[model samples]
Target: MSEPHPASVPLLEVAGLRVSAGSRMLVKDFALTLARGERVGLIGESGSGKSVTAAALTGLLPEELQICGTVRLDGVHYNLVGASDRQMSRIRGQRTGMVFQEPLSALNPLMRVGRQVAEALTQHGTLSGHAAAARSVELLASVQLPDPAEAARAYPHQLSGGQRQRVMLAMALANDPDLLICDEPTTALDVSVQHQMLQLISDGVARRGSGLLFITHDLAVAASICDRILVMRDGVLVEQGATADVFTRPQHDYTRGLLAASDLDATDSSGRLFTVSSAAGYVPAAARKRVPAAEPAVPDVPNSTVSESARPDDGAHSDIRDAEPLIRVSGLNRTYRRGRSSLFRAPSEVHALRDVSFEVAAGQRFGIVGESGSGKSTLLRILAGLDQPTSGSVQVAGNEVAGSRENELLELRRQLQIVFQDPMGSLNPRMRVRDLIAEPLLLPGEPVAARHHAGRVAEMLNAVGLPPDAAERFPHQFSGGQRQRIAIARALICEPRILVADEPVSALDVSVRAQVLNLLADLVDKYRLTLVFVSHDLGVVKHLCDTVAVMHQGRIVESGPTGQVYAAPEHEYTQRLVASSLSLQPGSSLPT
Candidate 1:
């Protein structure tokens, strides 16, 4: 028979791919065909087997995982099922490159990032030693990393999230593989950095005529990069078609739900957000009923715990601008010593916050928006009394936070609580959800009776839209969204007047993110709590916050009503941020 036509041979092909962990199947009947220079996206929520499918394709799955599949890469055998380590290793970098979701976890903390890139090149003898080292710097530079030479010498922990991700990209592209697999590589990135990353990935693949397998939970991101899109749900492909076709004319209910969730502008008349569920389908707001909160065990903060009727939209607080400020920061400055660069040099100081000042009125929904390294976290720490400012005034509910001693913070602790970004990291894995939610009540100088713990935990679980049985389960037993609910329940257990959420929904899938955002909105309204929400997502901040403060380079660059600021951002940085944000609305496109 004559040799197959060059155009007919696909760059990557998969048939009947399935992944199982014991009796449970993680991925089912996955199939794909990608031609050279083509881009395809696998879109799904968490636990939907997007990553599992990727792992199976890359031969990176654990040995314990049962995979029955065929993955064919160009120049490779027709069937790569059960490929051995030696066989897989030969093509891992030279033929296929995989960029993982979390670069921090994927990268070696002890190794310098540049050295890691060099190692990728040194493997398979493409380049070694000095040549590889120089090529590594070139790769880093190609990814548009600022000061690539300096970045090369730094460890993964030393770099920002965006920088670390760029480093991962540098490594993934070091060998110009025939196929590139990026697994939610931009999930944790800020919109601006995420835009750059997507462009870089596109450019990299375009330059080498490489086929791309991009996996993500974000429809906007998938739209920005992929030519074709495959919607995965519950370990199976529900729909597959051209990117525009699938997005605009979704045939499956799950696909429609994903689209509905992605359209952040869409909301019910009551301003309730929408979320998708495998069980209940998708609609206005979460399906679960809001559970009433238990009465405060201690003297609650004045005007802190308002009834549902007192919600801001109900016209109960029309004069919110004239209300007494719940939080005030004036001339805030936080500096940390970096020790001496060299023994004889004067000590270096990193200015984490510079003259940062803002006020949150009682029951006000305040937002702080900034990219990484913009001092948002530093400001949050000072507000929470976790760190002292070098020079500033931080008053929460008329109590001093900056420079306050631990013993002097009991009242403040009861008045304010924080919900961190990564619930898994913030929560104790070994503790039952009951204990975790009730732990706040056991704070120093404030103790609730053991008899009340069960009642309170159950109430909190219901308040956060979780099942009552969730209180007895461990954090590991819950999904990412569920774990975040647990974190939120724990933060609200003490009925704190102020809730400071730091990037709480940044890591969630679109559907889950909508659920969390809506929950936070409803909780803030119901409890009349002062919310200081920090996020890099401009769209989210605009949707949820009344007032927003734009931060950049350790200072508050702009502060005004969210609508005004978003409509016409004055600061250049703020303008860039607004332009860089991705939207799934009609006519939305990736920023140039």
Candidate 2:
């Protein structure tokens, strides 16, 4: 079926948009037209030029890139092909507002959240300071931030990921822009929060009658909220049509490839590990038909003999009652106290986690999925021994976390490690790769010398797909993917039995994400380690975890085997999560 064409004049238009970094073309012949009050979604994988095109529209391309295109905002025609910084700045934040992927970095840390939103309003027009602040609070309230007045006084660090995004939205809408461009705004948010954020943007845009250009790598997200869709590849528009029609019947080969790649098929139940092949080119139908019919089709599992033999050790610990959990939490709770006010004023308490309980078995891969502000990270922090639960029991390797002495906690720390999502921020700029990997080995009782440490570092580096010589390089010298590998190496240096990875692959590119996930899977089997994998990506969780736990409002709403939970999600939130994941193939539902 043909898609409905825009009835009104386009608020933003681009023609023959081309961009290059050095000699390599990043975007080519990209074109899109967004009508006033319309919502258009751009979908693709990482490095597909979705972000580049969004940046170009606002003249926010990096200095190194050379662009050539005709960009029209409303009736104003400007050649974005080679526009100057000054020319671009005049249009940015005035006629258009941008919501970035990472709101923490996008917002100013030093300024009050309300003030930041007000600044956007005050900069573009004649609003006074008090009026701007009042409008900013109203904007915050519109995005559904609790206690909007008090929230306005908070800084970016004081807010949760969802709250930070809300603040970003408030700031972006402060001036009532003609066009709002959101670049992966919900990428970092959990499933339910992601839904709410998308809905919020759609609602606000409709209310203001402003045009929207939503850029995301997630197809399902686009499907849920977009009016029209544009599929981009290598900076070119591969397909453009109504959201339903394009996803249902993608015409372009590139678009079809993207759809196929996003499939979440389970690994074959016949005890085989499946390796992902990312070679350039498409799989022929004849070759696919030649495969044995008896072989089970599991989507993300690596096909390798080694993986086949490495079945989970469920039988070794058959007596579930007798088996000890690698990590256990009972009645765990966490609370944060707001700063003091006047003498008579009581400090406000934020209950981040309220009596959460769960157990992780040895050699088992467990998942914790939740929305923003659900205390998922808080629970993880307590599990990693980075933070103490307010009032409850946490037992790690058979030691009571609350009753353990400082030395006992330190000993427990060696058996537990965490890998955060932002690898670049976690790594030290001054430290060499060798030291970064070896730092965990320097515990008081360990006897390895510096020379032996270097050897161990080399081994670990190679295990995670880094060169042996990577040990000598600095953190800044590596790409985002490589730095994450270093972080993994550092976490595993002490051979911790329990590895807590908090959204480890959320920030990486799609191709790199697959590589890291595979590396982690191998390490988990080789070390017989228990993994606590926390993430918002259902596809990754399904591929790696044996068990899944869904968290909502700081409580575990659903817990079961990965297959069971995904196949029959009892909770509405879980169902939504499974639904929110983008499928490469059109009209393909999750296993349920």
Candidate 3:
């Protein structure tokens, strides 16, 4: 037996690897290699074999899936595919470490944060007892966590999303593994937090002299982290090259479509935006019927209840300087008292919103941008009537929102509807699609029959580009983007005067994100509904909103027209947000 030369063998390598589930191939002829201290990114849309490839490498795939070909990822030259359970167990924490997409699901619920990290180091025949505990605290501190001692004692749920992600990073590098696989780690984070986390990952990998396999749908993020890139589509490698060349001059149509769909900084002034058709394809789908460029901007949809009559005099695309305001918030304040329920602790009030004010005119697209715990959610909750303000004057459509009676509240609910960020969380798993969308119309005092509900539901399905037969399926059966469309359909069932969207497209993939955004823009134009959107991505805000307000801490730090505020940010926090967000422009360097 001859050992491979250390100078020639790469730290990570996959040759002709293929993964399949029954007769369906998930990944075919996948080949990748990473030298020491190299960062390689695998980019693709959902169901494009990125996660499956990662699973195959890490031995995380379920038993039903069949894996073939060669995979050489080792800390001590051990085989990965057919290793014994005990041998595989030893390889996981000691040889290669993995950071999963969702920290809450990955981290143990009943364990302390420090114990989780310590177990990785101790169970793998390394540090133990006080030594492990000390190293765990050191790892947390190295990740720039505040008050490392307190964080070590806190449970997984006690930490914020960014904090939990940092903990995962600390654990991944615990034993100083030779290779690391991070799967969509920052997919759910705000721009500020996402930039910081990416920096932390890069720093950690560099400190350990480890190779990284970064998998994500974000192209700009890939450019920032990975030196090399692989583009996958429909279980095959469409293109592979250096990050710069691939991004600036992609050869494959699939790669081009992904790039066009993910360009958030794109706008009308930046040239005609590259748009992917409704049908799924790298190139334009053969069945797609595009409208002439000269026609009105609004898309034509058959069997849609939304029409010219549904729209107000002011359209979404028109300049709304002369339009009347629909929502007004003046000096709003919301305070929450902590430790009030405990007899031994003195109650301390936390100001969630302080003197916040903004206005949304009829048919105006208004965006509220902020990071987590920046009071954006608090302001949105108050507007949705889910929370009461401590002191403020809030008015919607000439109706006072503060201290309304039950009947008045019901009326307000009908006039204003809200769509949440997580589509699956907002939908009912047990209910059929038709019944779920019809729930709003079935409210008391409405004279609607079963036949009418079915008709209205079918019409909305057609409008959202879903099939009529989809009504028979449950929410769990649909994809994440489809569930979001269903959520949007439910919000529009009653034809509400105002639509409040809270990060509606953040959870979707690049292509699905474009589709959903186009749908929202069309709905706003056709129905003339005022939109109040909350997001952390400034590029998204600039594209969809005419005006934007930057929220920091508990106050409105900056507010102006979208282009003005974005182009010349005055506040420090606002400027940082714009700088940290990924760019759509070519040759753009990622945040460090």
Query: What's each prediction's TM-score?
Result: 0.89, 0.77, 0.89
Better of 2 and 3 by TM-score: 3
Alpha carbon lDDT at 506, candidate 1: 89
> RMSD to native for every prediction?
7.9, 6.1, 6.3
How high is the CA lDDT of each candidate model?
0.83, 0.76, 0.80
lDDT of 1 at 436: 90
Clashes of each: 0, 14, 0
TM-score of 3: 0.89
TM-score of 1: 0.89
Which is better, 2 or 3, measured by lDDT? 3
For residues 180-273, write the lDDT of model 3, one tens digit per residue: 8999999989898898898899888888778899999988788788878899887899999977677766787777778767764332221222
Worst 10 residues of 2 by lDDT: 304-313
Error of 1 at 82 (Å): 2.8
lDDT of 1: 0.83
